[model samples]
Target: MFLAFFLIGLCIFYFYSIKKFVFFSQKSIKHDPPVPIFGNHVQVAFGRRTQTEVFNSLYKRYPSEKIVGYYKGTKPEFLVRDPEIIKHVLNTNFSEFCNRGVRRDPKVEPLMLNMFSEDGSVWKLLRHNLSPAFSGSKLKSMFPIIVSCTNKLVTVAKELALEGKEFDACILCARFTIDLVGASGFGIDMNTINNEQSLFLKLRELMFIKSNWQMFLYGIHDLFPESFIKKIHISRPQVRLIIKQILDSVRSQRTNDTNPRNDFINLLLELGKVGKISGESLETDANGKYKEMEMDFNDDHIIAQLFIFFMAGFETSSTTMSYAMHKLAFHPEIQQEVQREIDKSLAKHNNKLCYESVSEMVLLELIVKECLRLFPPAGYTSRISSNDCVLPDVNVEIKKGTKIIIPIQGIQLDPVYFENPEQFNPKRFLHETLQPRHKYAYIPFGEGPRKCIGARLGTLETMAGLAAVLNKFDIKTSPSSTRNIHPNRAAYLIQFIDGGLPLRLTLREKSSVISNGFP
Candidate 1:
């Protein structure tokens, strides 16, 4: 009798799981056929293909369709291809697709409660409060902190150039950005640029190396948010303990301070002192009226924000700078043009790398923008519908809880929108050239309200770091470097180079030439 009952239950489960494979068929939307439990993401789930590759394949396959349907396990997902649909999802009908749909149990993983992972009311409130911290004035005030880090980077680059060493640009830029985050975000000197064995660097490395079992656990959690997967811990206990200890130590030192330091930690501390984060409501009631809402800004919330700040701040900026260096190495003439612009700008600033000087390096900025277009740090972003709605231009009805993916990399590389999309062309970003393009076509920092708050800061850091290096030294492709870069299949959301980016460095002869107007 027990055996008969078990067989009955197994049959029921099998049909129930496979039922979702027909989701797109019923909706009349095009999609790849899904298997029972793996859904359409079999390649990604089994590690045969990275998420970016899978998404790109689906995007290319359905050229005529505005949206392509897929499944993550049993959950239905929509991959949006039309720029109009994307704009609607990101801006026009934002209320219906506001959340990123990344649910996290605050009790199990306190750090996951950050603004980046948060949904709905909590995200709105936190974003409102945190927006001021990244304002123009605040970033300008923090410029000196970034300059100090850049100075250290220049010192290390000179030593590397003098020794005629071939180094991985990926690791080199990561160390520089890590040091910037340490000083600017937490008001601590990590000295990672000089100290190869820094504890913080080890922690950063460990965060990216997830075990196979851990990846399975994350998949389970993503597919079955209401199931027993909540009990599974996504983060390592040792890492959490170490991060908490660091936060506690820093908090204790700043608790009694009256003067504001204007750093990220101090900014959060100030917001916490206010007790609650209030904002205009994004949600409307049945009566069609918006109401004000507030969320508590407690210690856990503060720690969560700080954690994301450090993670996003360092990772995105460093990856961008590394890729920029890689591109410049291959294109020597472009590199020379960028260096000339940097020198001209610095000459006006008395040979100092200041905010005003960096702002004047237009060609350098264009080069970084082009690098981002080719290799966006966050290749794709998703949004889940909060209510049943029709997409603006396509008029496709989307059900509540359905996931929508915006393929930033695919859109940026699509030849339909960009001419010779594979070629590294910085001129595409020139003001007049950019004016005619679709606004949503190039979204490295994403679009609409949920766009990365650290966009400006990240750009500043990348340009500043590049300027500092190019001003003193020249980058060249090393024998260990690969002409064709491949993305790491195992990497998390960020698209990392398959292997480290290796490059050789040499001091620029123009470094000794002082401009007539500057010291």
Candidate 2:
């Protein structure tokens, strides 16, 4: 009887697969052929090539397909390749596609309920309450923190020069960003730059490394939604302990009431107070707003927000800065032009760099934008239909459970939107004709209301570190580094493919000094 039932189930599944493919008209949308069960992601799902390389290869193969349907096991997903459709997914019909295909069941993984894991009303509340933290005024206030970190970075670079050895600026940058995030996000003075073996540095490695099976899990999670599989539990005893220590410090500082200042933690504390009162007195809105007026931040919410910010801020900015340096090493002309611009801007401020002065560096900003185009920190953004909805410029109907992928890597490197897409040309961004190419063509930080909340802080942190390095040293590709390095996809997040990239740096004694490494 069991054998008979198994065979019957197999027949049903095989027919269902055929019927589903026919009903969806999968071939009409996809230029590349989807495998019997694997779909277009055979290389990625099976771990043959890196994620970036796999997607890049597919993108090159079918450059003109506006949409492609592929399977993650038996689950069907669409990779939207058209610029206008991507724009709609990102902006116009955003409500229909607000939630990403990710879930961190708070009951199971308490930390998952944080900003990155949530959607709908929860996301709305977290995002709304936190938006002010990164406003122009807030970032302006936070500029001094960045400058402090950058000064440390410059000091480190100089010390390395004195040692007369290659400094892994990539690792150094990570340490600097970690310190900046620790100070601003959690109110911890984790001077990771000076003490390479600081608790913060170790925690960062523990939090972000890609081990054998651990590496495979990133792809598995992305390919197969967690609801369908058993949850992979990660125990960060050290991280949890560290956060408790940090919170204890915060609570102790609050008790003193002697040195209360404006920082992210303080802001969250104020919101928590407001949220608590609002939870009682005011009648709540449909979206969980209080109709009666009492406000206080949930204790967990504060921790979650801080957790996401620290994780997102430090690593994303560090990887991006490193990749930009890699791009510069290959394209020295662009690097020189940016260096000249940085010098010109600094000279205006008497060769002293400040937040306002950094803001005014147009070419510097363009270079950053161009680098982001090629090596987006978070390469792709995924969304699920919040509700069944039709999007503009497409005939295909999106159902409630259907998954949508915005191919950032594919679109950013597509020639149709960006002429000579592979070339690292900052001027492409400055050209007037290319100005209106596609709204979604350059969405490294993303677009519209749901864009990266930490964008301003990320940009400031990245610029500060890059400016500091440029001020003290000349950066070049190491002979050990790949000629044109590519990212490893299994270790997704912040665009790093390999364990890390290493650069060789030489001290800049005079403005016009040249070295063997210089192109």
Candidate 3:
């Protein structure tokens, strides 16, 4: 029968493939015991552990090895432990490891063509176009709007302080961030805190919908290429509607505006115009002189880039701010010290917090760094091989399709990298004693060319928001807080732990108005 022959052929192919890797292997590193098929992912199936925990365990098990090999379903995965090899993969021989390793065919999944999934030449070109948009000058231009959003957040916090005398700062912080993203990214004031049914909030809900079925489908898609094509799809109809609305508004506004607002949406509109009038690719001369390149910038490109920026700008920074508040609540002494610094800085000025004053807040910068170390926004990062390459010390070759992850959470918590890594010590960053830490050890925003494009803007927004909150009230941990934070495993990229960082906020005797010099 044809069915019998097909089954026999599949068995033969599977057996031969396994034998090619397991029996007649090119090279292999001894990894912690792996199960058949799922390998280390078996722990993930029962909810007994997370990918981060698995990676951390492997790191400890093979501390001496530069690269440890494991399998994510039959596919080989490299758990890169050595910083030297990590640097090579991320920087030195980057071409060989340029891809993010996610397989989402843009034709089949048109929405997946954003920065996170694109690879090689396509990634380079897209990254180049997007990078220039978020320069320091651009962020400075958007500072006032960010401050205004914070003002609204502080007002809400003040009301909550009066009502219950204590509240969850994380909730207020997240709400403020969501509002800021809507206003700054799309040039639309969402007022998410006041308007519960805002379109922006609805879009956010869709983004974080943690259904087990959705996770299972995505996991299957990640592990097995064949299943990815046939998996049940999850659609964000609300998000699509919001994007369509914004895009249409932006397009119309771009035509009418004599003087446009200095925000992301306006910049995108201008870029879209450039593509319309000119072309997509920049032209060059035979003599290497500047000439106009010609490729049309389509709606898809514009929408995709803007959507990515909105998602990145809001979520990552908000998560960082949340964790910082959580730690500050529990460690009141540190909170008091930070408040004193904010006070001293404000006292220098006529008592107004402005753009320039924020830059000069060195202590605030150190605190932010410490916060990033403890609760890195994007906990871990993975890269796929663009071509065959070998790690620095190891003879093992990483073939194309290999997934390499840098465990940011594990590295940040390693005592070897930080003294008492578990402790909430802001001073560890301030103090330059004991031992020198590795540069790549704390990659909160990642490193090299593919580093977070909006890192500066994200950090500035967070600092501005925190400064606004601290000026109005003193915060401490509520008794209902958790002792140790555990991530909601269902979500990706960010970790919002259980209990949601409840905190007690007492109104300050007087609100401090620090005049930051530069306008």
Candidate 4:
């Protein structure tokens, strides 16, 4: 009798949930039939594929689709395949699609209320204050920190080169970035470069634990109604407490310092002094004028910002560098091209890396650009309609609160924009040849007013990481390495290699000697 009752309850639940899944069919939009609770994400939820693979597959399968309907569980999501429609959503008609579709209640999970996650007034305020901190001049001031960290990276490469065994590139780059971010953002040497058991490494392990269960819960956040998400706190409490402690400790140190450093910590400290910020909101009144909105930079807000900065700092640059190394390992000719560029730049700067030095290496930049094409760190980006808006190209009206998915990886791989897209061809990014390509088709760092604020800084740091490795050693595919690299299923949005990017390093005969006076 009990078994029969449980089966009856489940049947009722499934039938009730299907009502929300009819959103696409009502609008006559094309979409795959959704299953009970997983919607179209059963494969992903069950760990059969990563989000990148799922979106990329759907995108290619619907070549004629201007906008394909999707479901993140019962939550309706629309996949934007056409470049013109993508432009309208991302840039031209941005305000209408400015909100993140997912509901965020900071009281329940303060850490989720970050620049990357929040929208409307809160996002605008944070972006306005954070924007100046990443300017060229500020990055120039941070160059020494990058140089010092990359030099340590080179030193680590030397030891690995002597050992002559394949090492995990993901872990290796993670260490370098941990040190750089720890020093630049918090004003402390993380010491992760040389020590495997570094506390910061342990801290990161706690911060981003990957599992099928975590991914399921993430989907559930979008799956349920806003009321359900608002009532529950998803971020780990123990993790939140540890991060808060770190934030408090750092504030104290920077506060007591006489000559404060011009770094990320100092930048945030300066913002905190202003108490609050008022900005022209992304949302507008019926008159179409942007309304004004303001927000405070309290301890909760400050700590949340710090968490994103720390997480983004270590994750993005490290993922890019690891993927870049993987490409170089497989394509020696392309690797040789970038190595020559690195050598010329280092020689020009007397074996030292400076901010200006990075700009001069166009070939190296091309390599990084192409690497991002294949393995964009974020893989995809999202937005929601704040008001009813018609897609300019398709003439389809998107209703308020409808989610728009921009598949960055899929667009980058589309043959319409790129020929032989799977081939690792850095020369495709040559300035002379890149003019005619669709601008929106290659958004490793998105497009429009809401694009990543740290694009230049992040790209520069990644270039430096790759430059350091190529400067000291040659990256080659190991005997254990395969041509077909598997994406890590548990890495959430990061395009992590499953077993890590394994590559062998050999000391370069022509490497510029880093003596005592290089810096």
Candidate 5:
């Protein structure tokens, strides 16, 4: 009797699993065959293949279909290939697909409740309030802080040239960016550029270092439901404590201050004084006028925003500048052209690396844009449907809670839009050359209202760092440098080079180096 009951239970479980796995087939959507329990993301869940590789494979496999169905465990996801559909999801139909579907409890992990992780009304309010903090005037106010960091970077490069030591450009750029963020965002002197044992730098490395268990937890988080994942706390206790202590100290130091310093912390303090952050409502009234909505701005909110600012600002700019320098090392002619442009701009401004001077370097700007196109910091961006909606370009109905991935790397690398996509071509961004391509084809910073909030600040920081390095030294491929970079499979969100970016440096003539008061 016991054996018969066990057999009956097994049959029931198998049938239910089968029913869950056939969701795409029932909807008449084209999808890859899914295995039981693991679904189509077995390799990804196990860390055998990076998300980019999996998306790229699916993108190529279904050439004719605008949308391809796949499963992350039993949950169905849509991989969008068409540019028009991507634009619609990200822009025209944004109201129905605003959330990123990433969830974390604020009480468990206060650092995770930032603008990047939050969705719905909270995201809207925070975005509206923080948007003004990154304006042109505010960025200009912070230029001196960035220039100070770049000067230190140039000094380090000069020392490296004199020593004739080969170093990883990735690490070198990261140190410079960390110092910049410390000074400009938090009003602290990290001094990471000169000190190898900086506390903040060490903590940052520890925070991002992925272990086997952490990866497994991430897999479970992605495959299972949010409620199940919420029950298990994945964040490190020490890291959270350290961050909380630092924030508390900073807040205490500036408790009674009323003056504005134009830094990120100051802006947050001002917002807190207002008690709440307000924004235009996503839902419209009968007359088509949007209503206003607001949310609380407390200590937790402050810490969360500051955390994301530091993470996004430091990582994205450093990677971009490092990749640009690596590419310039291989292409001497292009490097020379960019240097000429930089020289002309500096000469016009009496050798000052100020905002106006860097802004005038058009050739350098094009090079940076091309570098971003080739290797975006965030390879892909995702959105989740809030309600059942039909894709504008393609007549396909997507159900609520369905995941949508916009493959930035695949789209930017497609030969249909870009000629010689494999080659490093800065000329493609010129007015005449760029006129013929689809507007939505290239999205390094993403699109629409949900685009990166710190785009201008990031561009300014990258260009400044690049100009500082190129003005003082000549970058060349070291013995350890590789022509092709392989993306690491371990890093799921941000794509990192498999091996570090190694390069050698040599000092330029004193006459060629701009040494008048600025980097």
Candidate 6:
């Protein structure tokens, strides 16, 4: 009786997993064969490949197909490779495809419910409340904090240059950005620059290295819907502990702060006092008019927002800065040309690294944009239909819960949109030299209303870091450094370098005061 029951269970398991994965074939879409439970993501789920690698492979595999179908376990997902189709998914009919495939419950996985991951009414309310914090005026107000943090970066880099030994550029930049985010976002002095063994730095590093359960959780995160996967926890215990501690520390410090600066912490404090996040809803009534919605803004919600802010800033900006530096180290002539631009801008602004001066660095802007094109931190963008709708360009019908992927890395690297896409050329972005392509083809910070909220601040931070380093130091390849960087296969979400970026730096004999700051 026992043997018979075991055999029956085995058959049922196989039947449920394999039989339900026929949506692609029934729709007559192109896709590779999937395994029983792992589906098409067996490699990523088991930690053998990076997500970007999988995206690029699938994208290049079917060049002719505008939309390709694949299975994430028993669930069917589509990869929209065509720019026209991508635009529809991202903007044209955004209301129908607004969820980023997230259905995690806030009570169970609260930290994951930030603006980046929340869906529908919750996302709408958070976006409304947080929009003002990233405004041009607010970023300008946060400029001094950013500048002070960059000075710490410069000082640390000066020490590393003087040491005359190769250093892990990834860790160095990560420290700088962490400090910047802490100061600018929360109005606190993180000062991780001086202490290499800081727990905050360690926590940041450990966050990306997924545990066994986390790997399984994220692997199937989009594969199954909320109905099947209820009460799932989002982060590791240590990650939660550290983030909570940071929040507690901030709250305690602010109690004594007579004058809280214009920052995220103050914004959060105000939200706490209000006791709710109310705004015009992203969802409209049948009449197409938006309704007002109020969100339950508890302490967990605040932590989730702050968690994403720190994680996003710490990983993305550092990767860009390190990659840009690595590229400059290889192409010194281009580095010199960019340095000239930085010098010119600083001189015009009376040798000060202010908002006005940073804006004037056009070449610097081009370089950062090109870097984003080549190495978008998000790798790929995915969304699920909020309701069934036919895509405008392709006219293909996707169901209410069907997933759509915009492979950002793959599209940016396509030779059709960019010439010699692998070759790093900043001039390709120059308006006079840029070839006309679909605007949706290059979305490093993504496009449309649901795009990256902190893109401007992140870009300015990247530009400032690169300018400061180049102004004061000469960098070159180190003996330990790899000529080309490969994304770490083990990374959870962010595209981390396979090995930390290592480079040798030397202080420039002729450096300007603006290398650190204007004063």
Most TM-score-accurate candidate: 6
In model 6, what lDDT does residue 282 have?
Answer: 80
| Alpha-carbon local distance difference test for all models | 0.84, 0.71, 0.71, 0.81, 0.83, 0.83
Which has the higher lDDT value, candidate number 2 or candidate number 4?
A: 4
TM-score of 6: 0.95
- Model 3 per-residue lDDT tens digits across residues 424-515: 77778765655667778878888876788888888888888887777778776677777578766666545555456677777888666644
lDDT rank order: 1, 6, 5, 4, 2, 3
For all candidates, what are the clash counts?
0, 24, 15, 0, 0, 1
User: Worst ten-residue run, lDDT, model 5?
Assistant: 510-519
Q: After superposition, how far is residue 270 of candidate 1 from its true place, in Å?
A: 2.5
Q: Residue 361 error for model 4, in Å?
A: 0.7
Off by over 4 Å in 6: 1-4, 220-229, 432-434, 515-519
Backbone clashes (count) for model 3: 15
> How far in Å is the alpha carbon of 36 misplaced in model 4?
2.9
TM-score of candidate 4 against the unseen true structure: 0.94
Each candidate's TM vs. the true structure?
0.94, 0.87, 0.89, 0.94, 0.94, 0.95
Residue by residue across 47-110, what tens digits does model 6's lDDT show?
7888788878999999988988777777788998999988888888788888896556667776
Give the poorly placed runs of model 5, Cα more than 4 Å off.
1-15, 26-28, 256-259, 431-434, 510-519
For model 1, the run of ten residues with the poorest summed lDDT: 510-519
Q: Which lDDT value does model 4 have at 96?
A: 82
- Give lDDT for model 4: 0.81
lDDT of candidate 5 over 324-370, digit per residue (tens): 99999999999988887887888888787889999998888888888
